[model samples]
Target: MLDQKFATLPKLILQIVQMLQNQSPSDSLNEIIRLVARKFVGLGVLEVADELEIQEAILRLEKEIIDLEATINSASDIKLAYAHNSKLEASGKIVFTGQGAYMCQVSAGGDVLAEKKDSIFRGGRLIVTGNAVLNELGSPMATPTMVEFVFGRRILVNRVYPGVSFRVGRQLFKVQEGLQDVRVAVDEQGILRVDYLYKEHLQ
Candidate 1:
């Protein structure tokens, strides 16, 4: 039964078992003493104590599997976050246009030394192209230029409820999730409309 349980254990646990199995015979014997105490609970009569100990070991192994699963999930989330930040493929350039804006161009390059009015570029995001120099603030309602971050990086604003925000505009947007739907919009209200609709889709 122990052998079967060991075989079904998670890969990490299996590696641990193999490590123990390869230990010196003296080491294995000493460790087995503890295993017996914890895993042999089910044996009846004269061996009842040994059986109960084995049962306890089996319980521990099960718990280890559960713990391993949780760890894997956490690793997955971290990996996803990293993918969103670095190693992300930049698709195309999004140009920002506003009143008195012209000949402004933004590219997929993380770093582009471009100038525009009311626009600020940072962290190698969307390229802004049009008339006039890019200013940090184009319109309060819309991002003059921005990138769609695949993974939303959270910032703690309020310690109580874990208030978080992402970077946006000239500054960080401080969104709970990453940015979404980054496009250049024409007209005043149109930019705001684009941001609102795109943000919803991102969620």
Candidate 2:
């Protein structure tokens, strides 16, 4: 017996292929994102306690089509630092309390960070001068979230939505599938890599 969840994926792919043949990549991306958002339900992109949360996230994702390579700048509501490493002392830290953060952008610098649960950074972008550690980004739903750094080279996150884009210097990484607890960084070779780091340093 075929599983009900995967039933529409093949059809979706066929539609995408046809769209590609008839339209430019940019022209078809919006539709493709929409189809993916609708089809990805129960596909296990996130591990949440309630089904409602998943639906809410998906609904939010459907609002914005992800742009993988476009330069992103989120309208910010919070500013933690100015990227000079002077505002925060070595012992300083940044914290996001209950409900994490939603619908607004956060800009920070350096390595001091921690967040509570229910974090879904949708509809905004994050600008950090250094490393950015986030509990969640984007959503299983498919909205694209951007994290930009002019001087930093790393971003660590526990949960990733499919369209989360990271820009570190000239390197760019766009997550096309859901991921958990990974590191995104530019290596010594100046190449960007997404992988797991068993131990992390927090300041």
Q: Superposing all C-alpha atoms, what RMSD in Å does each candidate have to the true structure?
A: 16.3, 22.0
Model 2, span 1-203: residue lDDT tens = 12342454445445445544633455445654555566454554343445554444444333322332121222223333122212222222345544554545556644424455554465457766667677777766667677776543577788777777888767788877777787887667777788864423222
lDDT of 1 at 65: 46
Model 2's alpha-carbon lDDT is 0.56
lDDT of each: 0.32, 0.56
* Candidate 1 local lDDT, 1-203, one digit each (tens): 55554343344345445544533334443454456444442442235345445455556655544544554343111101111123232232233333212222223322222223423332333332222122332222333333332222211111100112223343444333333323223333322112322332221
Clashing residue pairs in candidate 2 (N, C-alpha, C atoms within 3 angstroms): none
The runs of at least 3 residues in candidate 1 whose Cα sits more than 4 Å from the true structure, single-residue gaps closed, are 1-12, 15-49, 75-146, 149-192, 195-203
lDDT of 1: 0.32
Q: Give the lDDT of residue 11 in candidate 2.
A: 54
Which residues of candidate 2, in runs, are more than 4 Å off? 1-94, 150-152, 196-203
